[model samples]
Target: MRATSIILPALVTALFLPATSPALAQMAPPPVTDDVNLSLQVEDWVKAETARVILVVDLAGQAGGVNRADLLKTAAAIADRTDWRVIAMDKVSDSAGLDRWRAMLETRLPEGRLAGLAERAKRASKPGQQVRIAAVRFEPTLQEMEAARSALRVKLYARIKDEIALLQQTFPDRRYRVQSLRFNENSGGYRDAAPPPPPPFIPPPEIQMIGDPIRTEVIEEVAPANESGSGQEDKMIVQAMVSLGAFAGPTQ
Candidate 1:
C-alpha cells in the first residue's frame, strides 16, 4: 500500500507535466470571440501628436461582465495612455433601453463627425452583433499621410541603424542605395489627363567593369539637335552605357 501511494503520486505528477509536441508548441492562441464589444479612446497625447495608436478591447462572455459602468471604467483605463478616440458598445433588447443607451453615447462623443458615428451605433442591432469603433484624424491630402509614414520610417530607421551597420560590416562587399523619382503634370491642351511617361532608364556606373580581360563597351546613337531649340536639348540624346570585362570576381 505504501509503494502504491508513492507510485500513484509520481504517476499523477508525470501525467500533469507539460506535454511536448512540435505542432502544439507552434500553434497560436485562439482568436477573440465574435460577440465581443469593441471600443476606442482617443488620448490627449495622441490627438496632439502625429502617429495614431488604436486600442481594441473585447467584452464578451464572462471574461468580463457586461455592465455599463464596468465597461466605461475599462475604457477609461485604456484612454489614460493617450489622447485618442474611443468606440463603445452597449446591448439593448428594445426601444426603451436603446434610447437611454444612445443618450449616454451622445454625452461621450465629441461634436461633429464623431457624433455621426454615435448615431450609427445607436441604430445598429445589438444583443447578438458585436460593436466596433475606430478613431482616425482627418487629413486632406495623401501627402499628409505619407509625411506621417515617413516620420515613422525615420524613427524606425534610427532605432535599427546599429543592426544595419553590423550587417554591412559582416558583408563588406555589398552595396545598397535608395532611389526615388517624382512626375508632375501642368495643364496644357488635352481635356482628359494622360498617364505619365515611362521613366528614363539609367545605366549603372562603369567602374564595376574594371579588372576583366575581354572588354566590351555599349554605344547608343543620338538624334540631331534643332538650331531653334536650346543646346540643353542635345544632352537628352546621350544614352547610358555599361562596359563588361572578362576578369573573374569573387561571388557575392
Candidate 2:
C-alpha cells in the first residue's frame, strides 16, 4: 500500500491565511467619548470713548453638576482688567437660554450704534483688501480650562499693547495713551449720569473803538456748546473673548 500525506482542515485554513493578518489576533479598540465643549470668536465694536470687552458664554455638552456660577465668577475675574471693560455678561446652558439672551441683547443694543459700527467697519476696510477679524475655537477638557484661561490672559495683555500701538499710530500729532478702563454693569445707571451743567452762556465781549468813526459790526465767533449726550441707552458692547466649553463659536 502506497503511503499518502493527509492534511487536516485547520492546517489547510492556516496555509491560506495571510502572513501579516490582523483580523485573526487583534480586538477592536473601544469608542472614544468627547466631553469638551468650547468655542471662541472675535467681536469688535467701537464704544463711545474706547473699545469695550464683553463675554457671552454657553456651557453646552458639559457634564451635569458643574458650578456655573463659579464659572461666571472665574470669567469675571479674568475679564475684570483695567485695559478692557466687560460691557455685558451672560451665561446660558441651553438653546432657550441662548434665545432669551439674543432677544435681550437685540432690545438693549441701539440700532444707531450698530449702524455706526457698520459704517466704521466699511471705512476701515481697504478698497481692494478685506479686513478679516481674527477668531479661534477650541474644545478643551476640564483640565485644559486652566490652560485656556492662561492663553486668554496673554491675549488680553496683547490686546492692551495693540490698542496702545493703534492709538500712537493713528494719532501721531496728538499724544495718546492707553488708560485703564472700568466697566459699569448697570446700563440704566450709566445713561442716567446727569450731563454737566451747561457753561453759563457768556455774552460775547463787545469792543468799542472811539478812534475809528466807521461803524463796523464786530461779529464774535463763539465756540459751540459741547454735546454731553452719551451714546444710545443700554447699548450692549460685544468684545473678543473665549468660550468655556465645546460650544459652537459665534459666526460673523
Candidate 3:
C-alpha cells in the first residue's frame, strides 16, 4: 500500500473574551457600610506630607564580607541618624543579583529635605556597609489614608442620610433602613475598621475582594487634595453600592 499522509487544515477562529477581567469578589466594609454607599468617588484631600525614603544597602558580590543581619541593623541605625523616621528594614529581592536589604524611612519635612536626607544617609555608611537612598517620594501615610477613608465614610453617610430623610419625609408613612452597603474598590478590594460594630444586630457583611494579589487600599481609594484635582492628579474614587434589602410596612 502506498504511504499517504492526510493533512487536516487548521481551523482559525477568533475567540471572544471580556473586555476587562472580572473584578475580585465584592464585600461590605465597616464604618462605611453603616454610612451608606455608591460607585462613589470621594476625595481624601490629605496633605501629601508623608514621604517614603528608601535606603538600599548593597551587600552583593563584595570583596569585604559583611553579615546580612548586621548590614540591615547598620542600615537601620544609619536611617535613624538621618532627618527621616525609620519605618522598617525590608529585604528586597533582586532577581538579576543577590537580594538587597532596604530600609524604609518617612518624613513630613519639606520636599527639599529629600535630597539632604539621601545625602546624609550615604555619608553615614560604614565600611562594607554602603547605604544609598534609592528613592524619595511623597505619599500618604497609613494614618492619613485611614483619616481620608474616615472622612469619605462620613461624606457618603451624609449623602445617604439626606436622601433617605428626604424620601421618608416625602412618604411620611414608610420606614427605610440600610440593609447592606458595599464598596468594591477599582482595585477590587477594601478594608474594615477595627473594634467591631456594636453587637445586638447582625454581624457585618462579608467583604469579597478581587484585586491585585498585593492589595494597596491607599493607592486604590485615597488621593491628595491638590489645588487642581484633574486627570492623574485627580483623587482616587472608591466605588460603592447600597442595598435597601428590607422596608417595614407602613406605620399605623
Clashing pairs in 2: 37-245, 37-246, 38-245, 38-246, 38-247
Which candidate ranks first by TM-score, i.e. highest? 3
Q: Whole-model Cα lDDT per candidate?
A: 0.31, 0.31, 0.46
The predicted structure with the larger TM-score, 1 or 3, is 3
Per-residue accuracy of model 1 over 41-101 as CA lDDT, tens digit each:
1111112123222222333333233555554454444333333333333332343333212
The C-alpha stretches of model 3 lying farther than 4 A from their native spots are 1-41, 59-112, 121-129, 186-234, 245-252
Backbone clash count, each prediction separately: 15, 5, 7
- lDDT by residue for model 2 over 1-252, one digit each (tens)? 233234566667766766466643333333332122222222222233322222222233333433545434533333233332222322334434432110000012222222233223234444322221111111223333344444544555566556546655765543433333332111122343667764544332321111113332221222211111243223222234321112222322
- Top of the candidates by lDDT: 3
Clashes of 2: 5
Candidate 1: minimum summed lDDT over ten consecutive residues — where?
231-240
lDDT for model 2, please: 0.31
Per residue, candidate 3 scores C-alpha lDDT tens digits across 1-252 of 233232222221112322342321122222222233334455444555645554445444443444555644655554443454454544444556565444333444444343355456667676645665544455656776667677777887777777678667876655667777776433211233345653333212211121223441111111223212221111435544775423443333
Clashes of 3: 7
